[model samples]
Target: MIRPNMERPTMKRREFLATTTALGALTLVTPGRLLAETPVAGGTLVWGHSETTQNLDMHQTGTASTSRVLQNIHNALVTVNSDMEVVPQLAESYEVSDDGLEYTFRLRAGVMFHDGSTLTSEDVKYSFERCADPETGATNFEVFNDVAGIETPDELTVIVRMTRPNAPFLARLAENGAGVVMPAGSGDIQGTTPVGAGPFRFIRREFGNEVVLERFDDYWDGPAHLERIIAREITEPTVRLTGLRTGELHMINDIPAERVAEVEGDASLQVLTWFPLNFDFLNFNHDLELFQDARVRRAFDLMIDKEMLLQGALWGQGETTASASFPNDAARNTDITQRGQDIAAARALLSEAGHPPGSLNVVFKVTTNYPYHVESAQIIAEWAREAGVNMTIEQLTWADWLSQVWVDRDFQMTMMNFFTIWEPDRLYFSLWHSTGGFNYRNINVPEIDALAEEARGTIDADARNALYRRIQDMVSEEALDVILWFRNGSIGARSEVAGLDTLVHPNGSNLNFHKVWLRS
Candidate 1:
C-alpha cells in the first residue's frame, strides 16, 4: 500500500505560488484609474473569444467555448473561487461519512431556475443520473460513474453513495462540464435556447455570430449587476484587438503575446495575464502501426526541440516539461531524464526500429483556429524530417478536426492544447486512465490503469502524489505524448470593465459575468 507524503503538507498550494504571484502583478489595473469609478447596474457587457462548436446542452458538449458562455447561464453544485478552492455553489453545505463513500448535500432553499422552477434535491438526482447514463453521451460520464446510487430523502437533501472512495469527487463537481446543473427532465437543452438557474438567463443565439444572455433577477446569490451579457464569436486575434481598440468589444481572450505590450500601452485597455493550467502537446494514435513500438515514439520525441517550438511558434509565452503531469505540482518528479534535440540519436533509434532514412511516412494534423498550432506543426515537421522521418502536415477546420480526430479517432498524430483540473489526480485519470473520456490516445498500459484506479481511492495527498510520480515517469519513458509547453493566458478588456479578470480557473470558466459590472 502507498503511504501519504506528509512531510510537505502544504506543498500543493505552494507549488502554484510562482504562477499566482505573476498573475497578481499582471492583473493590476492602471493606478487610480478605477478608484473613482463606481460599478453601475445597467450596461450590457459584450465579450469575444475564439469560436468552437456549440452544443447548448452543457452536459453533452463540454467544449471550452461553450462552457465560457454556460458559466453565467448556469450554476454548478460547486465552484472554484478566485483562490482556487472548491466551494459549494448550489449546495448550501455538504458532509461526508467516515469511510469516504457516502456524501450528502443540502440544496439551498428558494433558488430559482430561469423557468421559475424551484431548485430541489430531485433536480440534483436527475442531473447526476443523466450524466451517469451512457445514452446521454455526457462528456463527464466517466467522472460521474463513481456514483453507485443516489438517494433523495427529502426535497432539500441529496445523499450520494460512491462505489469507492473518490478524493477528487468534489473537485470534479467544480469542473466546467460536470458542475452545470439543469432542471430535472428539461429535455434536450440547446445552446441557442438554454434554461439554467445561473445569474444570467439565456436570451438568444445566432450561430457563428453571438450568444446573448440576460440577468436573472431571481438568482439565489443576487441578480447579475449587468442587465445583459453578449459573447460574440471573434475568430481572428487581430480583429479582436481591433474590436478592443474601437470599443466594439468590452473584453477578449487569448491576445497573442507579441501584441501584449501594445495592449498594455493603451490607457483605455488593461491586460490580465496568468499562467493558465493548460499545456500544448502532440498526441499519438497508438493504434496506428507506425507508433505501436515505444522505440519509435521515443525517437519522435527526441527529434523535436521544445525550446525552439516555444520561441518560434508561441513567441516565448510558455514553459516546457517532459512530464505528463502538471508541472506546477511539487509532486512532479523532476529527476527523470530530460529528452532534447538529438538528431543523431533519434536517427539511430529509428534505424534500430527497422526504419531507415525516409522509410516511414507520418501525417501531422492541426487546426487553424490557433495560429500557434500551425506554426508549431511546421517547426515539428522540419525537426522530424532532419531525422529522416517524412512528416506531412494536414490542416483542418476546428469542427472538422473534432469530428474526424476526436470522434472518429482516424488519424496518425494531432496537436492540441488541453487544460488540467484543479484536482491533480483527475488530470491523470482523464489522460491516462483507460475509461478517461479524453484519453483519445487509446493508451492502455495495465500498470498505469491500476495506478489511476488506486490514485482515485487514495485520499491522502502524499500517497496520491507518489502514485502520480510513478505514472508520469512511465508515460515519459514510453513517450506516450509530447508535452510541448505550459501556456500563459491573457484577457484583453476595457479599463471600464471590472471583475472580469477576478475569476480565472484552470477548467476554462474564466468569465464570471455575474461579478462583472460596468464602471461609471
Candidate 2:
C-alpha cells in the first residue's frame, strides 16, 4: 500500500477559512456555501466516477459505483465507520438475544424521509421483506435468506428472528444490497423512484453521463454541507487523473497505478491510499474435465509468477494472494503461504495428471473496463506457455463478457474481482456455496458447501473464524481457484479538499462525503 507522510504540514483552520472565503466569493456560491465561506459548513463536491452504474435499484444492482451513489441517497439501519466498525444509523441501539437467533433494534427518534414522512418500524420491515423477495432482483438476497420473520412491536422498534445463528448479521446489514431502506408500501416504485433518509435526495439521472442529488434540509444527523452533488461517469482512467489535476473534478475514484507518481508529483493534487478488503482471482471451470483434477489445478497455480504480475503488470499496486481471498480476512487461513513460481513442478504435476507434455488448450477471457485485467491475462498466458501450456486470450465488452463468458460459463478460465466488505460470511458463502449465484458452474465440492454452512450456522466469532480458516485451507489445497492478488485503493483529490478519510472496505461505497469540506 502507498503510505503518505502524515507528518507533512497541513493548512491550519484559520488559513483554510480565509482561502475558502476568497475562493467562495470569486466562484458562484450555492446552498452549501458554508463549505466555502465558513470552510466547514458546506459546498458542492464534484466527483468523477470511472464507470456508469447499470441500474439504480439498490437491491438489484451489485456494482460498487452504484452502491456509492445509493449510499448518498439512502441510509441503512447501521453504518460502517472508517475504522471498519459497525455503528448505528437509523437504529439508535440494538440488542441480540442470548441464543443469537433474534435481533432487536430501537429506531432513532425524529428521523424523516426526504418526502417529510417520519421513519418507522413498518418501513424497516418492508425494506427487508422487499430485499428478501426473489422478484425484487436483490443481488444480496443470500445474506438475508436465513431470516425467519421480521416483527415490529411498535413504531420505533424492529425485531428480527433468523432461522439459524448468524454472527455477521449486522455486518451484512451494512453491505451493499442491505444498506438501502425504502418507505413502506413503496415496493413497486423502487427503481422508478427511490426515497430514503440519507443526506442527499435523488433528483434525476441521465444514463451514461451523470446523476444529480440534492442535499436534504431535514436530514436527521444534520443538514448536509453540500447543496448539490453531481456524479459524472468518466470511463477513461487517464481522463479522470487529468480532470483532478486540472480542477475540473473535486475528486476522482480509481486512479490509475501508472499515473500515481505523476499525479502525486503535481502540486495541485493530493493522493490518498487505503488498504481495501478486496481481491481478484482466477476462476477455473471445475465442471470441465481438464480442470476437475486437483493435480492439474495445482500445476496451473505453480506456473504463474504472482510477484512478477504484481510488480510488472500491476505496477506494484497489489499484494500477492495466497488463497482465493484476502489474507487479512477473519476467515482467511494464515498458515498457507502462496505457492511460488515453479515451472518444473508445474510440468511434473501436469504429466502426472495425464497431460504428458504439460501442454493443454486453454482460453482466458477478460473484461475491457479494467485494463489491468486484460494485461494480467496476457502476462499469465505468456507464463503458462513457458510452463508448457497452450493458451488463447480473448477480450470482450463488459456486458458480453459478463453474460457469455462468466454467466454462461463458455470459457476454460476467466479473470474476475470481488469487491468484498468486512464480512467474510457473505463473501465466501456467495462465491463458494453450491448454489451461489456467482459460483458460475464450479460448485461441485461438498466439503466446501458443508464448511460454509457450518460457518453460517455459528454465532460465536471465534468458531466462525476457525471455520473460515478451514475453508481457506481446503480450497487452497484443492486448488479450487488460483488467487492472483489483492488490489490497493487509490483516489486523487484536489489540494484544497479535506476530510477525505481512508477507505477500509474497497467496495466503492465511500462514506466520507458527509464529513468532507472544501478549503477556500
Candidate 3:
C-alpha cells in the first residue's frame, strides 16, 4: 500500500459550504477521535457497494461504483481533500502563465506506477494525450477540447497550452477521469488489464462480485498500512447493512434512509454523512414534441411539490431548491422563486399549452435501483393526474435507462440524479450547453450556450459567478428541467474503521484509502 507523507489538513473554513449529497448526518464517530487515535497496520478493509461494475477504466465510464475502487488504483495531478479544497496529488506543484492559456505542472520525482516503473513527465503527457485523443473516445473528451497542445520539456515537467483561457480548467483536471495518470503505451485502457500509481495495486476483479487490491509495498511515500482492500458488490441494501452489522464488511455506502437510525443506535456501527453534491431531477426530453411548449414544461414544474417529494420520497433527508445548480454554490440564483404546488396555476398553463383534460399523455421513465427515483415517480404521477395530464411510470434498469434515454433519446421524461462535479462548468454547462456531449435533454438555447462559453473564459471569480447566476436564472425561467432537492450522501461503516469519517468529496465516490486504517 502506498501512503502519502503529506501535510495534515487545515481546519475547515467557515466559507466552506455544507455541500449537496444523497447522504444524511452521521452520529457515531468524530474527526477528533479518529485523529487522536493511533493507527494499526495490515488489516483488510472490505467495502460493500450496491451495483456491479464492468472494469476500472474511469475514462470510459464515470460511474460511482468504478470510482470507489479506482481512486485507490489511480493518482490524479490534483485532488480534492476532506475540506473540499483542490490539492496537489501526483504533481508536486503547478503554475499558470500570465496569458492564462498555459498551465505548467512539475511532476513528483519519486512517484512510481503500479508496474514498478518510475514516474516521469512522459507518462503524464501520455495519460492526458490519450484521453484528449479523438480516437480514444474518452467520455470526458469535451473537457479537453480547449487543449491546444502538450509539451514535456523534461522528465519532471509537463506544460499544457490551451486554445482559450478556461477558468475552470484547473478544477476540471481534478475531476475523476481527467485527473488520473495512466501508463504510457499500455494496452487497451478499458481492457481487463489495469495499472496505476495509487496507494493500492489491482490484484484481481471478480466480475459482479468484488474487486481485490493489495497495498503496493514500494509506493513512493511509503507502503499503506492496510494489507488489502476489497470492494464487494452487495446490490441489496438489507444484505449490505447486515454485512456491516455482522462485521463481514468494514464499510458500506448507499444506506437506506430508514436504516440510518438503526445504524446509529448500534454502538458497533458508524454513519458518516457526506457534503450534499447530489440531486434527483426529472430531465425533460426536449426533443419530444410533448415538452416543446415552455408553458407545458412550466406546468410540470408547478404541479409537483418539492417539499412533499423530499418528505415522502427522500424521507425528509434532502433540501428543496428551485434552481438547477446546487443551492450552496456561489453562482446559484437565490432570487428565483419556486412555483410551489399550485394546481390551478398548473392547469391554466396546461390549458394555455392546448393540453385540456386528457390531451397530454407521456411516460415518466425512472430507475428502481436508487433512492427517490421510484418514489418520486409514483408521487409525480399522482400530481400529474390532478393537473389533467396522463403520466405513467416505467421503471428500467440502469443499463436500459442509459441506452433508452441517454443514447436513444426515446423517452418523454426521465428521472435521474445529477451526481455533480465540484465545478459549475461541469455541473451546469456540460449538461446544458448546446454542443455538450452529455446534453441528453435537447436544450439548444443559443443565448445560454453563449453565456456558458463566456463564463468558461472569464478568469475573474466574481465575473464568472455572475455569468453562472444569469445562466441559472435562465434555466429556471425556461423550466428546461425540474429542479429537485439536493441530497446528502452517507457512509455506513464499523466503529473500528477510522480516517474515512474525515474525508469528504463531491458525491462521496472518490474514496481515499491511504489515510484509512483499522483501529487496534
lDDT of 2 by residue, 266-313 (tens): 666766654442478877888899899989889888988888988776
Give one digit per residue, the lDDT tens place, for model 3 in 404-443: 8877888999887766454788776777888775688888
Encode model 1's per-residue lDDT on 1-520: one tens digit a residue.
1111122212344346554542432355452465444568989888877765377888777467777787778888877654455668898887777787888888899999999999999898888888778888787887776788999999999999989888778777877677677889884754457788898888888877898889999999988789988888887888888998899998888887688877778777877776654678888998887788898999988988888888899787767767645455656778775588899999999999999988989998898877789888899899888999999999987777778887788899898877654465557777778777778788788899899888777778788788888988888889988778777777888877887545465443346777788884
Question: What is each predicted model's overall lDDT from 0 to 1?
Answer: 0.77, 0.73, 0.75
**Top-lDDT candidate index:** 1
**Can you give the TM-score per candidate against the true fold?**
0.93, 0.86, 0.91
Better-scoring candidate (lDDT), 2 or 3:
3
On a 0 to 1 TM-score scale, where does candidate 1 land against the true structure?
Answer: 0.93
What residue pairs clash in candidate 2, if any at all?
A: 19-520, 20-520, 32-42, 34-42, 35-42, 42-225
Worst 10 residues of 1 by lDDT: 1-10
Report the Cα lDDT for residue 500, model 1: 57
> What overall lDDT, based on C-alpha atoms, would model 3 receive against the true structure?
0.75
What TM-score, to 2 decimals, does candidate 2 have?
A: 0.86
**Root-mean-square deviation (CA) per prediction:** 3.3, 8.4, 4.3
